[model samples]
Target: MKLNLTPLFAALLLAGCASVGSVDPAPLPLAPGAYKTTAANDATALTASWWQSFADPVLDELVGRAMAANTSVQAAANRLAQARAVLGSAEASRLPQVGVAAGAGRAADPGARAITRYSAGLDLAYELDLGGRLLHERNASALDVQAREQLLADARLLVQANVARSYLALRALDAEREIVAGTVAAYGETLSLTEKRARAGDVADLDVARVQAELAANEAEALALERRRLELETALAVLLGEAASSFRLVPATWATALPAVPAGLPSELLQRRPDLAAARSQLQAAKARVGVAQAAWWPSLALTAQGGGASSELSNLLRSGASTWGIGLLAALPIFDGGRREAGVQAARAQLDGSAIAFREQFLLALKEVEDQLGALTLLRAQGEANARAVSAASQALRLSDTRYRNGLVSQLELLDARRSELANRRAALQVRSAQYQTTVGLIRALGGGWATGA
Candidate 1:
């Protein structure tokens, strides 16, 4: 039996066109603010651009160069541009497309009617978004643009952090080099004094030999420290997008203390971190994609219009009598596609699920980073204090040993040992200070300290 299917198709299309209210995912709950590992009061204020807290002009310059010339930052900017272009294309799809055509021709046929036609007119075509498919696509594209923008922001912040860390490392190496050089000089002097005493028969030859060995060891250490400093400078130069061979970082000896880091609640991280923002945008885009996929199960309607003129004479082509115009609507309904539409809907839902999970992961990682930095900073501070005390005690012991050797109250061996101990303590203290400063910088970066949304 033959059956009319137009009504059935129309009813299915109408049902598919029904609005699907947006699904709102629950906000993830964060831990309370009262969790504290130490008794020290937490600093409450966090800066978005925390690198400036160091007040180092050189560091500021390096960060600027990286932001401008770093290859990674450039790549991120390019991606953002691409995403915006895609968004513009999607928006344009929602508007009617128009075009103009003009042509001239002469034809002669041996048989029938030999006709020459000339036509000029504007043509228009518009897709009716009957089921909001185009709207969903446009919204998804816009969200993608926002996601790319946030990604670029995150990349810039990462580059800034890299430059700052590299600069800190170079400065720390410089400090270590100074410590090694001073120790070498002190060892050289001790060796010279032992030689003079040996010559005057006030000390044994073994005493002079031991002091000479200690001096040589210190010289080797000094050479190693200088080599490390050169390596660190090269690394810093590369981060600033400069040729390592052509670049030289002038060492700035700023012994300023590390700035205090502000520790807010874990919930604050969701608002401050760029990665989290990007993740949320990605989720929104995925959510919109689900609507776009669901809309595919419905029919699409399009309105098209065309007008033109044709005549043997060019003059007659402009006359309304010779003109032809027509307007029509086209509709398409997917009948049987071997379950492609259903598969698409399933894929879109899966993607939305993945995006949601990814957003939660980013949020949790941000929280973990803040906590790790906080604990590191706390331990580094305590270590710095203990190192300072050790340095002072070693300094006094070295001084006493030097006096005793000169008064013949102790051997050259004793003075050499004390000098070595003092040098080691000095180096260790400098290391602790360096670590403390670096950890504090890391904490500030983790807290989203150095960059703002527009900056």
Candidate 2:
């Protein structure tokens, strides 16, 4: 039979009328080229695994463990899987749907003789997608998958950065603990000297009491440092997805070498940051949903076909003479439904607006994070240098004061003051170093694990 092509052609022509209103989404604004603060020798491209730049084998191992086992990372992975499954389902909807049906029935009216019927059939159906509703839905689902993938990346970066920061903090605490222990020991020696001088009538007994009090204070400070260290160790264990009670990290010296990161142009950050990527993906998905909603306002067309055999006897169901078949074209247009379809369109558009705003907000947040970290690192470096000088001078003063006290040229209190000053200076220096490392990790995380351009 010759097909009627005129109606099909007319439907195709009117398909464009069903499209929802759309706005061309523009890219978010970015800051001008170059960051306000970037260190010398730091103009290198960011890498995917930025943590490896630290060159510490132990840290590398810890970060790897966290990436593989951290609960947050695992959760993000699961979400990505879910998004992929949804995308698959949406894509499958775009193709024809086929199903099978089989049935046997027996019925009787009043005392009439019973009759039986048996049937088996294959049913096929497909939406025409003239308005692109299914297409838009599939596209939205695909964008969701991409967004989830980006989220997984962001989660991994956060977990690694957290582990690094915790580890560095523990190391800093270890150094401070050693300083406090030394201070306690030195105070003990001073107390011993004060006691001897008191017995020899060279110093008053009150001097000996003051020395004992200072010794006790240093011991208490040492205990506090140990407590802080334990807390950091426990936190690190959790980040590594291990039982804190069963985990222990032995004290090790902090590495002097830190990876220098170049803050690339703010425009490059749009591609480098996983969070930004995720935001953009969500925006795309929202835009697709608006199209899907707009498509709903138009009539839907579906083609259905069924073929089957029916017979009163099950054995005769497949017989050639018992065959039955039918084909249908269904078109449904909602004249009115209390404005449900219009409401859906409005809601989708509202969501699109919100997503657009969110994308911009994420961009701003990414820029702020990079700037904050860079500024902090620059100041910390200067502070670290000043702290090193203070430590050196304090050490020299402590040595001279010790000699003077032994020669009876300085009071025991003066000797204790010098010793405390030197310890304080050393601990301060260690803290500055720790901050530098922590800030560097923060910067890396902010840059989305050093995502290189075009990655």
Candidate 3:
């Protein structure tokens, strides 16, 4: 009896695969039910178009433009497209490979006479995945495509958040410049009055000098604010993928509505962050690759066939006597190698371990960011309230001091002090409001846009 040992060898190789043990990954950090710095919960779930919640048309337009034009976002999109193409190629690999060929050749016959032959043929090959190698490879590629998709989402989120923050900072500068410009005007008026008093000998030259110094200082501050504002504008231009000189954001009232976004549960963040989703996909892909590498040690089976006709004359090739055909069953088993397959499996498992650890790190960072932004917003609200009160009190004090000084009941120094105090308070209040808007954006980004989990 004839005996075929291919099946027996395949079985033994599969058994060998069971001996390649995988290292168990360390446990992931537990997520709390709620963040330690959790705020009041709101009904707002995360949405992809989270920027619209801010209710600023200019901001909305800028974000849209940046999403379309930013180089980094474009690069991420290209990567996604490439990964999808690779996935298509992977999926197509399981299908039979077919080709057509036609050729004409001249050769010396056995009798030393020159002869010409014409042939046309169709060739086909199909690999049978008896060891699951092709299946695992396809699965790995599919998972990688998923990872690339999530990475694209992550890139968009980053660009949206940055555009919002930069625009907010620019608006804050507009408000600050308004305050400083007003102070400069007031200081200029005070200097005019002080010079008149010095000419009439009603006040000393020291008072005149102090007023002049205050006016110049306020003017200098106003100029500095303008410079900073221009820089921000230029920075924003770059964010929008334009030349700094060509992009100009007109100064306008700070009217971007600050949406109250509450911090959701910690569990929600795991599902909402694209970066985390990407890491998870990558980890799964690594696991799939390990299977592929381990499968390399097993046997592979394939089917091949070729059909053709050949004759001395092209027309004669169609005759039944000139027809030719072939079929083959190919089997391959790795009898011995210098540990290449084993090394591949080991390397694949190492990648799996790395991916798992990376996923854990990503989760930890996501949790920390959400908590950090939540805490900042919570504190910023109270700080804004206190600063507003200070501005109110300082304004009232400044009015009183101005009236008293004009009536000769107080020194000009006290009036200058009151004005300086009021300006400082106004600036502090503006800074606090700016922080509130920027922090809300941060919290929104940390929440992964509107609150729903990443798909």
* TM-score pick, better of 1 and 3: 3
User: Sort by TM-score, best first: what order?
Assistant: 3, 2, 1
Q: How much lDDT does each candidate structure score?
A: 0.74, 0.80, 0.82
Candidate 2: segments with Cα more than 4 A from true spot: 1-30, 42-46, 109-111, 263-270, 451-455
- Per lDDT, the best of the predicted structures is 3
Worst lDDT run of 10 residues, candidate 2, spans 8-17
Q: Model 2 — TM-score against the truth?
A: 0.91
lDDT of 2 at 305: 100
Count residue pairs with overlapping backbones in model 1: 8
lDDT of 2: 0.80
Tens digit of lDDT per residue, candidate 2, span 124-203? 99999989999999999999999999899888878889998998888778877878887788778778877887999999
Candidate 2 colliding pairs: none
The digit string of per-residue lDDT tens for model 1 on 95-140 reads 9999998998767767766677787877999999988899999998
The lDDT ranking, best first, is 3, 2, 1
Candidate 3 lDDT, 1-455, residue by residue in tens: 12232343233223223332453433656554455565655545546688887889999899989988988889999999998898888888899999999999999999999999999989999999887889888988998899899999999999999999999999999999999999998988888989898999999999989988988998899889888989889888877888998999999998898777544543444465788778778877888889899889889899999998999999999789998999999999988899999999889999877876787678678768877987898888789899989999999999999999989999999999999999999999999999988888888788677555542
In candidate 3 the C-alpha lDDT for residue 83 amounts to 88
